[model samples]
Target: MGHLWVIPAGPPLGSALVEKSEVVIRNFFLPFLFIRIGLLTDIFSIKDWKAFVSLGMILVAAYLGKVWGSLLSLIWFKTSTRNDLLFGCFLNIKGIIELLVFLRWIIYKPIDVQTFSTLVLFNLVLTAIVTPLISIFYKPRKRLDRISKIDNCIRTLQSTLPNSELRILCCIHHEDNVNGIINLLRASNPTEMNPICAYAVHLIDLVGRALPVIVPYNTQKRRLVANSTDRIMRAMTRYSKGSGAAVKVQPFKMISPYNTMHQSICKLVEDNLIPLVLLPFHENGEFQSRTACVQNFNKNVLSYAPCTVGIFVDRGLTYYHPSNICYNVAVFFLGGPDDREAMALVSRISSHPGMSITIFRIDLLENSVESENDRCLDDAVTKEFMVGNVGNTRVECHEMVANDSKQLMDAIKKEKDFELVIVDFAEGHMMSLLVIQSVESIKQGAKLLPP
Candidate 1:
């Protein structure tokens, strides 16, 4: 009955149900089973000298058989000697299946009491030592330590080389998120000279399964049970076809617990050398019920991600079809790394024929102190953007000065007419203040993109 639930035609089960079942089994049934087995086994049977010798022989034979058997099986595949040995060590661990078999054999008189005691002791001893043996034998490589400081700093739009493919990991939570994300992708200005490689990952909560899985869209034999994933895939496919080699998308479905979802995402980013990851804001109406889970996932991603992370708040961009309407984008730039990244992304968006970008460079008041290094970098990035888009009527730049959070809020309120507002969550500056205040002050029709 438990196995049948995994069938495609079976009734759907929620993650909560599986979680409750696991808790019950682990807390109640497993302990009872172990206690019953302990009561049935006789430790005195293995104390005799002859019994001790027989038990030692059985342990040696079982260890050799289990380890060598696994090693011999791996000869058909291409694997290193160390990995094969590690695999064998991992296979040495025995579990409830063996215990249940021992109980049945003892009840049916297939094995005597001495033999049963020897087998149970062998199982316990092997299981206990395998972990320490594995730890001693297998040492994993640290991928993060191998990454250079330059690589860490360059994983954003401002640092990407010219004519290079811009790789992005787009995380989709629901069908409603598809339209806003697709619009953003379209506004990225993919061209023959510079293409976009997008990895679309649909995150599903782990449910009704014993292990997590990441399934590729093209490899699945059956359609995904969730229609939301299918709809997102279809939308991405249509966009890919229409882009005519300017864009390529690889779709994946990652089913994992919320607590560990960010690890999978970060691993994907590291493996693919993705520069940017786009995430939906957790405060969206669709996510309100699971706000805490979604927020935790986003926070974990931000903390562990090796690249830049963008939190997108979709207001009404879903209604703005990229093919028909021109997108009015406003960028609020303050001097910092995050603001520079926002500017770099806006530079790309400004190149799209359907995009009109307004750059608002906000400066701190004379009374406020600024970091010289950060100010220099910000100026360099802004200068490069201006030089790149010289004489482009679609792009406009404005400069503003604000003394405090109130003035910054007023400045943002004046620009509420734009369809999209881009800001950076720059710490220890007016930018962060603006982000906190603008959440409520921004017009209802404007989308917000904060990195």
Candidate 2:
């Protein structure tokens, strides 16, 4: 009745009461009851599986029957295969209520001591096993469908406006992340013709919470939504207002489980038809690495995001100052879809008057030529940039051959004056083996790499 009647009615007090009651029962009642049961049971009796085979068979039959029946009933709802399995696993649990019923049966002597012990053990083992299984197998089916639709919408938008407005989804962890993202956006150089539409999400980790909420953030009554008093939202609003009419920023606050927040971020990006997602590097500015959870979130987001993604490692972004700074950006083109995407991004940034870009196309002699088809795609993107972005004069391209790690290191060491170095993150799903080899070599020779 606590979970069923109280929660659905939408009263905060009722939910709080229920949660408190659950805590009391779990902490005060259950442990004492379990201790009593343990004191009564004989370990020697549990070892007599042959004698308790009749009771064991009944437990197996009951457990399997419930699981199969639950799965069959769920099929009518058109749920994904994962949900069906998770539902079945959940139904298999014989939890606190069942434990209480067995205790009453034992007290009334409706069951023998041996039978009671066997059933108690069965209940304990089944619940423990099913709890972990439910967590492991539960994949929210709606999230996947949402991602698919987002991909379709983004593809349509890109085809329609190839050289125009670049829609970007930016993720902000806290107030500290706000300046870094804003500076990077400023460096991207938004203009009146080819503008930037940014959607910023203030990611909040939901701890001891039952619901996930997405709230739009602003200086109005909207702040009441999702208990949001976000400093990041305020900062982003200021940045958008000061940046002129060319750049548009939409601020949102998202609350989700830290472990699975990447799914929510990806869904939002897809829904908004965002072409690029700008994420902060997992390492903080103070030379401290963030938590493992954050690092994994970045990795998972890259795998699930439908659009191009860039991890911004903010090195002060001093080049963005308009008065006297000339931003020099160097992109290492290792050859792949991600590499092409990085080059396209650099070209977009190069449109700004104060920014100059250099494209370093690294050629591995051993694995130089693949297929005509792949080569055509890479060549087409490069040719398109040259032909279309002709008004921007400060751009250069270079071809270099590096057969081994030593040569790759030597090649990278040549660029000493670049303010920003952009490299395609390799080891993605579609990355070729040759590209992986070169990426590894670059990673191994990181001291020669630029800041």
Using TM-score, give the best candidate's number: 1
**Model 1 over residues 313-355: C-alpha lDDT tens digits?**
7664635554665767788776677787788777777778877
Q: Where does candidate 2 stray beyond 4 Å?
A: 1-37, 40-77, 80-82, 91-119, 128-160, 222-229, 285-290, 319-325, 429-451
Clashing pairs in 1: none
Poorest lDDT segment (10 consecutive residues) of candidate 2: 430-439
lDDT of 2 by residue, 1-451 (tens): 2564424421244445655687887789889998887766655556666868988898899888876877785569776666666777777774667877887887889986777788887887887788888767665645554554433435422242645887878888766677767777787778778788889887766643567777787555554434333566677777778778768888887767657887888778766777777776565645344456566776667656666666665545563454344777777776766666666666667767777877787876655655777678778877777776676678888888899746876778765556667776534422111111122333432322122
Overall lDDT per candidate, in order of appearance: 0.73, 0.66
- The segments of candidate 1 whose C-alpha lies over 4 angstroms from its true place after superposition are 1-28, 42-46, 60-89, 112-141, 148-155, 162-164, 191-194, 208-212, 219-226, 243-246, 257-260, 283-293, 363-371, 400-418, 426-451
The per-candidate count of clashes, in order, stands at: 0, 0
lDDT of 1: 0.73
Using lDDT as the measure, the top candidate is: 1
